[model samples]
Target: MLSPYKVVTIGDAMITMNPISTGPLRFVTHFERKVGGAELNFAIGCARLGLQSRWISLLGKDEFGRVIYNFTRGEGVDMTHVQFVEGYPTSLNFKEIQEDGSGKTFYYRYQSPISTFTTEMMKDEMLEGVALLHLTGVFLAIDPKNVELVQELIQIAKQKNIPISFDPNIRLKLWSIEEARKVYEMIFPDIDILLTGLDEFRLITGKDSEAELENFAAVYNIRDLVIKDGANGSKLYREGMWTRVSSFKVTPVDTVGAGDGFDAGYVYGWLHSYEPDKLLRFANGVGALVTTVSGDNEGLPYFEEVDAFINNELIIER
Candidate 1:
């Protein structure tokens, strides 16, 4: 049965041009066009798991924007709050993948349509039935104004008693570490769930030890602090206890979007009130599945797929 809970997120979606060859993008002639974004991928991940996922954002009234709109709508994500603006262009990025699935992204998102979005567009009705509001640093890094918008949204979510899940998803290309750290600290107190990468946590707090992590969670009063360590697994801190779960071993084709999938999985488990260990295992399975596929959200598994994969019942034919 599909969960009655609704997961909502706001951010920018882009037309991702992925290189066909596994090398420098300069030498690659053929490319495959697809849709990708941090928050958008999270919405898609939630939708794939049979959660009511809503995406709120602005896009250009261009072909790329239309493609993203149609693609996301097809993924079963609610697009009621997504809009298209004039003049500004839809964001875009080209990916360069190496043999080991590591890659780089070159962004061409100047004057992005999302830049036109204002906090005024955010209304109480938007959170009318939302069970969770997920935020990421990707959107907050796009424009200085977005920080205020996110703060406003956080306030609205808090007023409504909706839990907020945050992922730092830090991108150095978009903003500096100093700038990101400042904004993160300002908002960390309000966060109920913090899903962050191990490296990002270290960079943000200057702490690497598990004890420090627990102390950070306690200081911030965060209910759930989730550390996503790619390939190593995930760790969760809640109620003065820490639970660690191992990652599923998989040969990766693309590493992008795995964390977003993990966020969705963790949120899903949280809403269902899964035990800490089971929650981390479920989230780890989702993240591991994402790395096995090439596209951003294509590998985000359905609940049945995740159950099978976690239970060792899934059979992949080569």
Candidate 2:
């Protein structure tokens, strides 16, 4: 059964082709196909945790698009708002992983189908039962018009009194730091929950101190300021109070979608009204679990799995 809480997010999904062997892409002959995207991963993560997750986006009317659509739908994400369009091609990315599980992606999405999605296509009815509206920098970075679309969506979300969560998820490969900073600043004031990395926060605010982060949150009137520090832990600031949680230790197979899982777990805790400490710990656990498996949303755990993992009851088979 689905949880009463619902999460809605808008972004582009892509067909990711990961190299079968470690090292340079040039030397790899075979690849494995997978579906991946920031918002899509978050939606799948939420769905895995039993939330009614709705995704909004456009995909190319092609084989790859069908694969992505089927995979995401099978994960229990609501597909009512997703559409396939002709002419444009679905986006694709090829990943090159090093021996240590770290990797870089090469994108081939110049003619993205999501570029056709406009603000006019967004309807207020789509957000009717949404408990949270999530956004990310990846969508905004895809196209300049997406900035306006997100702004319009934010206005509608605000009108409907839905809380907004945003993850910068900054990708320098998509845009310059200057460009990202400008766009992020424009969206920051409207974000109620800010989920970002410590490095990203420093980069975005150009401030290195916790005091400055507090002042920035105060300036924006952000209710929840969550910082996700991989491996080290995560910290949360709400109502002028701070809650910190240490990360669970895990050997990562791939670190690609860990942050998205963390976002989903955080949202799940938020909807269930978990205390700050428990929320951060749960989120950190989800993130660590994601790194224990490969693929995009493949490692996103159900509520039961997360519970077991957090309690140190989960056993892995080699």
Q: Pick the candidate with the highest lDDT.
A: 2
For residue 285, model 2's alpha carbon misses the true position, in angstroms, by 0.9
Model 2 alpha-carbon miss at residue 141, Å: 0.4
User: In model 2, how large is the Cα lDDT of residue 230?
Assistant: 97
Count clashing pairs, candidate 2.
Answer: 0
**lDDT tens digits, residues 244-293, model 1?**
99999888877789999999999999999999999999999999888888
- Show the lowest summed lDDT stretch of 10 residues, model 1: 309-318
> In candidate 1, how many Å is residue 313 off?
0.5
Off-target runs (Cα >4 Å) in candidate 2 are 99-102
TM-score of each: 0.97, 0.97
**Which residue runs does candidate 1 get wrong by more than 4 Å?**
98-102
Error of 1 at 123 (Å): 0.6
Angstrom error of the Cα, residue 11, model 1: value is 0.4
lDDT of the candidates, in the order given? 0.93, 0.93
